[model samples]
Target: MTVPLLAITAWSGTGKTTLLQQVIPELNALGVRCGLIKHTHHEMEVDTPGKDSYLLRKAGADQVIVASDRRWALMCETPQQPLSLAELAARMDSSVLDLVLVEGFKGEPVPKIVLWRRGVKGGVEDLLDEHVIAVASDEPLQTGLPALDMRQPAQVAAFIARWRAAYR
Candidate 1:
């Protein structure tokens, strides 16, 4: 079976990453095996310069897998092409993960929990799409989606658990 996926989306500095950092551990304590995918707007280098994986990519290897005793990581060199969220999730080990939490790609066709902070410059309002399932914020939103308390981790986790249970 495919693992369920949920996108945590927000504009820059809206605290999506912070929220995820809090949520992931809490969910893990509840026995949820979670995987994360973070979307970047600029070029990102996981393999440092002068490293073996970095040198291999510099030498034109399309993909590089680095493994050690403790962990492993795969770096795929795709400069311009953007993979859909589904395509990216396929690269993950679905058998071991119960859920995949995406950190960006708000426009992707998946349920999203949006982080909204007052005085923020950008938000989901400009997206012109209906992918957002709920909003987590400090202030109230006029949109009809459920507004979750950003300070409450239990509430957020419960919301996710309840949603998953309904479908399961």
Candidate 2:
């Protein structure tokens, strides 16, 4: 019952997020319950200042949870450690998901598609990794692996859905 984890990874300005923005709907159209995990290196604030959750967290609370009728968000301060992709993936409720689109963690060993284009920084590492499950690119690629259309999300979504089904 493991949720399939896939990634759309490339260097900055390579349209990783943009592509997923399109792909999410495509996944939805195909009836896939998708969960997304985004990796960021910069320090960020998910809780707001002056909010009770923020105030409590600021006063040395290790974790804070906030909820409304529609949704809830949890904020935890990890001063001692940073979570890896697997660690974060473990936090996902796999019972509610058919797929998890991991937006980064390019260095992690996992099944993924290496989104690439010329003039971007990802080409070299992609060539070195056999674990790269596919290539989604604008231009034609020489690799015999499945070459997908980065512009057409449907084609990419179909590929992913088939890959997801095959693994089950």
Candidate 3:
């Protein structure tokens, strides 16, 4: 199976995650199985405080696996180094996913669809590069790249589907 990876990127308040909320379902309707990787700067916790797994982690356990009848979650504590996007994707269950949509990692050399909003710190000029396959924006841009309206999820999904086909 050919698993393709694409990225959605924009400034902090530009709704990268919000767009994925709609795009994932749209892609599903189009028969595309999706996985997502999100980048964050804050220190995040996957285990709830005061829980057994949390306690074990706080006591210096490097990794913890919590499993139940319905699901299983693996939390690894690595304060020294973080996993790269490729590293994280390698750990995904490849048998079920057809595409991996990455959010952020704007500087990484990857095929990315950038989102541009008016007065959102950076303009399309900053987003222009060979890896940027398209631009989804609230305002018209002159970057000569294919631009999609931000209000239309179905249209965006279609564009992604076409790209995914070519990518495959």
Candidate 4:
């Protein structure tokens, strides 16, 4: 079965990641195995230089898998073609994940929870689109859509849990 996908989308400094940090634990407590895919615009490196895995990757290896007793990671070089949301989500093992939460990719067609605050770059309406399934804000908002209090991660997690249930 295809795992349910949801996005926590917002502008920079809107606390999207912070909210997820809290909500994920609440989800775990509720027995939802969540897999997360975070999108970043900046250049990022997860491996340290001079390390075997890093050296192998830098030495023209297109893909490298580093495994240990605890966990494993696969690093693939995709400089030529940027990965799409579907591609990234497909990389996740759906058998173990009940839901996949995307941290960004607001422009994508996936359903998302739009976040807003009293003083931010733009209003919640600016982010509204057909893909938006709900709106979470620090202040009260009457947008005809499901409104969630950003301060309470439990409430958000409960909503997500219900959403996941329906997806199944």
Query: Could you say which candidate leads in TM-score?
Result: 4
Among the numbered candidates, top lDDT falls to 4
Candidate 4: C-alpha lDDT? 0.94
**Residues 22-126, candidate 1, lDDT per residue (tens digit)?**
888878877777899999999777899998789988999988889999999988877788788889999999989888999988778888888888778776486
Q: Residue by residue across 1-168, what tens digits does model 3's lDDT show?
A: 647789998888999988999999999999988999899989788789999999998999998999999999888877888988888888788799989999999988889999989988977788777899999998777778899987788989999999998886
Residue 159 of model 3 has an lDDT of 96
Question: Could you give me the TM-score of model 1 versus the true structure?
Answer: 0.91
**What overall lDDT, based on C-alpha atoms, would model 1 receive against the true structure?**
0.83
Q: Which ten contiguous residues of candidate 2 have the minimum total lDDT?
A: 122-131
lDDT of 4 by residue, 12-117 (tens): 8999999999999999999999999999999999999999899889999999999999999989999899989999999999989999999989899998999999
Indicate whether candidate 1 or candidate 4 has the larger TM-score. Answer: 4
TM-score of each: 0.91, 0.94, 0.94, 0.98
Model 4 regions lying over 4 Å from their true place: none
In model 1, the clashing pairs are none
lDDT for 37 in candidate 4 is 95
Q: Higher-lDDT candidate among 2 and 3?
A: 3
Candidates' C-alpha lDDT: 0.83, 0.85, 0.88, 0.94
> On a 0 to 1 TM-score scale, where does candidate 2 land against the true structure?
0.94
lDDT of 2 by residue, 1-168 (tens): 788898777777788899999999998999998999998878899888998889999999998889999998878788998888888888889999999999877877888888887898646355437668888889888777888989999999999999999979
